[model samples]
Target: MIGLTTYLERAQTGVWDLPAAFLPHAYFDAVVRAGGIAVLLPPQAVDDRVADRVLDTLDGLIVTGGKDVDPARYGAPAHPETDEPRRDRDAWEDALLRRAIDRELPFLGICRGAQVLNVALGGSLHQHLPELVGDRRYQLGGGAYSSAAVAVTPDTLLADVLEATPSLDVPVYHHQAIDRVADGLVVTATTADGVIEAVELPTVPFGIAVQWHPEVDSNDLRLFAALVDEAARYSAEHTARHSSRTRHPEPAR
Candidate 1:
């Protein structure tokens, strides 16, 4: 099973405003395309016990893209360009990543998910990209994707999955990006503009995060497939461990 994170949004179905958990179908499509069961995990209060109990049941996790991570988390004031705070989602996902480190669970972070992943690892964000780049090469329009080529570090997990010299014209949309990468993670790819595009934790079997939305791209499902493939292995190993424990029951007094 794969757990995909979702956020709360206002959906107008009737004449009243109601908060609802929502996510794009592409997320579920990506998971299913990779031969895994897709389950959307809604944003909730920060409860470690609840997080652990729920997470322990899933083989992998995909932190979906959404609102910006409150700059307060990385010790920065909110930038005027930053989106409204999604504190509940931020706290929820942060807690999940914190627990993920110990479980050695597979994680694939996308867009805002990438930012949260970095912050959860004690890293910081730029808060706003336009200020640093001095141009809008990362995101073309307001929230639409702008195509750019990314140079992959040879022999890295990203390079292996991409299986080519450079990733060509991947969809990108963001105003904030990774600043000081977590010491635990290594840079795997970057754009010609020197912006961080991908990262992975060497300590874990599969801890990968990308700044762009791979799930949004209908042409390539490599990133999602890689995650699900690793997740399947995790599920198999976990089941085997459980079976062994059940067969060799602890002796009763």
Candidate 2:
């Protein structure tokens, strides 16, 4: 099963208007299309123990796109363009990510999810990309996606998964980018402007994240398919190990 993080935001539906734990259908849709079961992980009070409990239930984890991560996480003051702190979500995702990393869980990050991975691993964010890039090319506003030509690094997991030529035009809609990349992450993709577009944890079986919204591009399921394939392998190994333990319990003193 693929555990996908979600946005805990206020919503309005028939005869009701209240805070809800929901996610865009597009994310789960992509997971299902890639041949995996989708499980929603809404923001909640979390500790390492709680996070591990959640992770123990799934074979893969996905940190989906959403509001900007709080700058305070990386010892930086908030930028004028930064969104107000989503403390609950931030804490929840951080704990889960750290635990996921420890367990080497197969995972993927999208947009803000990528930023979280960086910060959780002693990295920082640019806060306002337009301010640094001198234009809003990454974010065109009005909930519309702008395209970016990202060059994928050769001989990297990202390149292997994408099987891309040299570069790919991807849908992007973010105002921030990785500033000081985390120590253990390998930069796997970048744009013409030198913006970090993707990173992967080389130590893990399958840990990759992209600044672009892969879910938005319905035609390209390469990334999702790669994740699902790894998740299936992980699940199979995990199940076999558990069965072996169950079938042959250690002798009691």
Candidate 3:
């Protein structure tokens, strides 16, 4: 089954509430549209051992969009524009993502989730795009989504899945962007102002992160479909591995 990690939104009391965990419809819609069963993973149960256990059972990982990541994660000073930081959630997801990477599990990160993936992999963020990029129309009107056009790199995984030229209009609602890209990751897409829009780890099985919210775009089914197909393949492989070990026990290793 495909498992997607859900981030916890902090309340005023600074307590991580499990019941408060929720994800946008676009996330579920994308997963469902891709023919994968969407399983919501709790942020509270995301320690290293637990993450490893979860990864052992799952086929793919989807890190959904949420609030800004704590700057301390990427070795940066806190930006004044930063909002309520979910430290616990950060720790949990980081461990989960690390385990996923070690297992080479297919991962799809969106918006803040993309930032988290970058930071987890030794990268930094801009914190506030307006201050860093200057007069950019990142946050769309009505606090909804980004209407910016992202230029996709040719000969990239995302480009292959999208099947579009180089550029495509995407929805953006983030004020932060990837500054220093993570090691083993390549910039696959960007905005006109040079904002990092998408990143892909070429060596990995299927690791991709996008600064935009493709979930919010109903027309963007190809992206999610690709992820789901990968997940299905992973599931088949995992099941076969387990069955082989069970049926033909290795001779007294």
Candidate 4:
């Protein structure tokens, strides 16, 4: 099963209700298209042990996009541009992500989720892309979906899995982007204005984060398919490991 972590959005009165929230259709479509069972992970009963067990049982993780992350996470002062923070969801997902990484689990981060991943790994973000990148047009008219061309790196895993040309026009909807990429992560794609559009940690088996919402784009099925494929691989390996352990009891010490 692919465990997709849902972001916690703050409600009135400083409360968070993850279970009551619904994920975007595009996110569900992408997971289904990838041929994996998508499970929405709420901020429910999450602790160190629970996180470890969840990571142990899941095949892959998908961090879905939502509101802007709290600036305090990356050691930056609050910016006026920063929107309402989702502290509950942020803390839950961050813990889950850290556990997933420790177990070397494959992960895919979308939009705000990508920012969380980058920040979790000691990376920083342009709190506001337009102000930082000096591109006032970066927001794409505040639309839900905007078309932007991303130049994919040929030698990266994304380029190989995508199996497409060096550059392709992808849909983008993001106000912030990765400024200083995380350690050991390489920028795999970027926009025409030189905004970091995608990133991948080469050392990890399968870690990719894209600024664009591939889930929303019908043409971007390949991205989800790749993630599902990885999930399946992880599942098969986990099953085999468990089976082996069951069949072959440990020898007497």
Candidate 5:
């Protein structure tokens, strides 16, 4: 099963108000097309045990994009444009990400998810792109997507999955970006402006994070397919181990 993170939204589910765990259908649809069962994992208490329990059940994890990671996390002063951090999500995803790394679960992080992955691994973000880039070329307008021409770095997981495409058109939507990449991550793709569009961990068989919402494209299922393939292998191995343990019970002293 592939576990996906969700956002809390308020709605009138009843006579009164209510906050519901909400996730975009695109995430679920992408996972389904990639040959994996999708499960929505709402944020729980900031406990290691809780995080581990959730991570243990899933073969892979996809941290969806959302509000900015708390600036306090990386000890950076929040820029005027930076939105206030969602404390609940920060606590939950922080624990979830740390545990996922510990467990080595196949991880695919989206835009903000990509940022969270970087921060979780001791990296940082640019916070605001317009000031750094001097223009809004990457972002077109609100509720719309800008197209970016991406250059994939060879000898990386991204190129391997996309078959070394010299250039590819991808939907872009983000102001914050990876500033200092994490320790084990290698840059796999970028735009002409050199913004980090995709990254992967050399330590894992399938640990990838992309700034573009690959899940947004119905045709480009390569990224999700790669993750699902890795997740399937993980699930099979996990099931085999469980069966072996059950068959050969440990002797009590």
Candidate 6:
């Protein structure tokens, strides 16, 4: 099963307005198309034990994009443009991700998910891309996506999945970028302007994240497919390990 993080936001339908835990269907749709079961993981009361129990039920995890990760997470003052803090969601995802890494759960992160992974590992963000890049190219207003070409570093998981293409034009819509990369993470892709576009935890079986929104493109299932492939392997190995433990139980003193 592939567990996906979701947005906890207020919404309106018909004559009612209320808070909801939801995610764009595109994310789960992509997972299903890639031959995996999709599970929604909404923000909630969480601790290490709660997060571990959740991870125990899934073979893979996907940190979907939404809301700015409160800057207080990285010990920096919030920029005027930063979205108001979602303390619940931030704390929930942070707990889940830290434990997920410890368990080496096959995982993927998109857009804001990328930032969460970075900050979860002692990294910081630029906060406002327009200030650093002198333009709003990465985030066109009104829910529109802008395309930016990024160069992929050869010999990385992203390169292998993308077939070692020297560069690719990807759909992007974010105002923050990774500034100080965390330890145990490797830069895998970047735009010409040197903005971090992708990163991967080399120590894990599958821990890759892209600043671009691959889910935005209906035709591109390469990334999702790669994640599902790894998840399948992880599932098989997990089952075998469980079976072995069952067949040969350790003696109790």
Give per-residue CA lDDT, model 5, range 25-137, as digits (tens): 99989999889999998766779998988888899999998778888888899999788878788788888888888877898999988898899888999988999889877
- Writing each residue's lDDT as its tens digit, candidate 6 over 174-219 gives 9999999999899999999999999999999899999999998999
N/CA/C clash count, model 3: 1
Residue pair clashes in candidate 2? none
Residues 23-94, candidate 2: write the lDDT tens digits. Answer: 989899999999999999999989999999999999899999999999999999998899999989999999
Q: How do the candidates rank by TM-score, highest first?
A: 6, 2, 1, 5, 3, 4
- Whole-model Cα lDDT of every candidate shown, in order: 0.87, 0.94, 0.84, 0.81, 0.87, 0.94
Candidates in order, TM-scores: namely 0.95, 0.98, 0.92, 0.90, 0.94, 0.99
User: What TM-score would candidate 1 get against the native?
Assistant: 0.95
When 1 and 3 are scored with lDDT, the better candidate is: 1
Superior candidate under lDDT, 4 versus 6: 6
lDDT at position 173, candidate 6:
94
Cα shift from native, residue 212, model 4 (Å): 0.7
Q: What is residue 236's positional error in candidate 6, in angstroms?
A: 0.6
Against the true structure, candidate 4 has what lDDT? Answer: 0.81
Candidate 4 error regions (>4 Å): 10-19, 133-136, 141-143
Candidate 1 clashing pairs? Answer: none
lDDT of 3 by residue, 1-253 (tens): 6677775664343565444677767788778887888889867855678888878877888888887899998887898988678887788788878888888899898888789888998999998999867765897547666588889999999888888568989888888899999888899999878999999888878989899888888876877888888888888888899899999998895
